[model samples]
Target chain A: MPRPAVEFWFEFASTYSYLSVMRIERVAEAAGVEVAWKPFLLGPVFLALGWNDSPFNIYPPKGRYMWRDLERLAMKEGLPFHRPSRFPRNGLLAARVALVGVEAGWVAPFARAVMTANFAEDREIGEAAVIEDILRALGLPADEVMARAQADANKLALRCQTERAAELGLFGAPSFRVGEELFWGNDRLEDALAWACAGAA
Target chain B: MPRPAVEFWFEFASTYSYLSVMRIERVAEAAGVEVAWKPFLLGPVFLALGWNDSPFNIYPPKGRYMWRDLERLAMKEGLPFHRPSRFPRNGLLAARVALVGVEAGWVAPFARAVMTANFAEDREIGEAAVIEDILRALGLPADEVMARAQADANKLALRCQTERAAELGLFGAPSFRVGEELFWGNDRLEDALAWACAGAA
Candidate 1:
């Protein structure tokens, strides 16, 4: 029997998601679970809380420790981690583009590439040109996908997804949903995958 | 030359600290770094941020994931972990008592014992009897130490230390400070110890 599928909800601008995106495939495979990529924006969710920025940035100590912790965790995982100069960057374009890719069945790879470019490579994922180049590199129609990503329906779907995330008690990025069980952060991916496999059994 | 001393700031109610407290001794030994235990209340720090409860509790997704992830991490680290019925328990008394222990040079053992009682034994560290029993078991003067813990000077000292933590940009428990470097979370203990040893060199 095939293992049950777990949804990996992520935001393009989230640092932890960058780590999750890099490792989810192998980890899920080892745990004998399938994964579905769900790309959404956290900015709208933060806005609903009446916050204009990342909570990490507002709390310096958490922010400082987070950066250092990321460096250490990345080293342990053998992944590249470069602290981005601008955090909580405008992920609007990235989110929209991710929606288009999800619709085109290229969400996982596109999301991973975008996240690596932003967190690991320190590239500006906010810029349309950067996202377009990434889409093209993935052998997708860059101009056509970019045009569809800017459509009213795609933007509205992204908003609806954000609302769904909030309703499901999600308050951060890099959250995974194994049926009704919600696991947050990159560190919890292994456990979430295990839980999903167990549930399938 | 001896390695420079590193401060291991912790809270009794923090789950991550339990893991750190359990493994810090061996890790610090390998890195040739000394550890000074610093205990303080996270309640006041939360209040300062205008939050009435633990951010994890307020954010259900994060909270649920934290508990589950902690379980997996504990198992992997060969430690016991079970979610306590009462969370965000009053850690003030424990913190104050830790202050007295620090002054008496029994902070490390006391901190470890308290953490084990809370996370492993699933006992309430907030209860006076539980704490007293722990101290008495260690052949310490429980009553006298508890009394000294309430002294005005000790209380003030805890406040000042917390303020210093805030100034240093700490937002959570299980943080380590080596000179000006700050490392957060149980996972960063190894790196923090290495940093301390390097600084001493």
Candidate 2:
């Protein structure tokens, strides 16, 4: 029998997504649930909803509150946090690279490293060189991974995944899907896990 | 010394505020904290942010997810759940009445009753008759309370409180203020309580 599982859909550029990506693996493992790390872009989804920029950027007060909320949450989780100089940095390259890692079963660590670079260390993960640095640091073959990441198939895979997110009616990132149930935001992580567990019963 | 207290800023029409309003007293009491009920309007706040409609209604996917999320949260919180036929019912009259309740030491129960009317019972609380029914159900003189609620002073006081919310950077309902620290959403109720307690310590 398959272990209780949830599909975690996240975008690297999302601040709330940073919270979930950092803790999901540990939380899921401890709860005896399997997590399917689904890296997708929120840009297209936002575009379809008629938002050209991050909603946090489009709405200033919400944006201001988000950073402070992230700070408090990071402290609670015992994670280091440094505000990024940029808001909603490009995640195309990192996401494409994550698609490659997914196939190799290293997506979790690769994604975490990219999130740390973007949110914690304020590194630009959009550049190929920075991604290469992350891969090499993770003891993976940076050159080969970069080659696969830029290839036609990986790019389209990300597009399809994003379309899937829109179809799932997702308006934001760090969303979790347990069966057909959708849970949004970092706070709902525990609830999603609980739902997955309850469904298995 | 005064008990460690949190000023709960809420809008009567907000769904999440219903969740907080229903359980805040119990939760705050258990934490040994005091709750300062501040009934305010979100209409002005939303307008200041250039959102004429509820963000949930403006963004369909978000609106859809919100109802489902509210249902899940209500179930988790052991509160009754029902979907309101109308979204974003006007809370001006309700807010004014709550201002009256605030002075009479009945704001907590009054706010909870209004929230239950809007969310759990699907009643149109925007109507003066419905609000009067609720006030009378609590054994208060409905005619006197309603008359005071419509008075110029009480109406203006509610307006001032709403302006206060905007000045505090409150873009949403069910926001908790501990000193200058602001915690938004029902999920942050505990965090706000903790912040209050921590500040007192």
TM-score of each: 0.83, 0.98
Candidate topping TM-score: 2
Which segments of model 2 are wrong by more than 4 Å?
none
Best by DockQ: 2
> Which regions of candidate 1 are displaced past 4 Å?
A26-33, A48-50, A71-85, A120-124, A151-153, A196-201, B4-6, B26-33, B67-86, B116-124, B193-201
**How much lDDT does candidate 1 score?**
0.83
The global Cα lDDT (0 to 1) of model 2 is: 0.92
DockQ of all predictions against the true structure, Cα-based: 0.51, 0.90
Clash number by candidate, in order: 1, 0
Candidate 1, residues B1-201, lDDT tens digits: the string is: 765788998888888888988888778877777888888777777777777888778766567768876887888899877788788777788889999988898887888888888887878888999999999999999999988988899899999988877777777888888888788788667777777877777
Candidate 2, chain A: TM-score? Answer: 0.98
Q: At residue A160, what lDDT does model 1 achieve?
A: 90
Q: What are the per-model C-alpha RMSD values against the true structure?
A: 3.5, 0.9
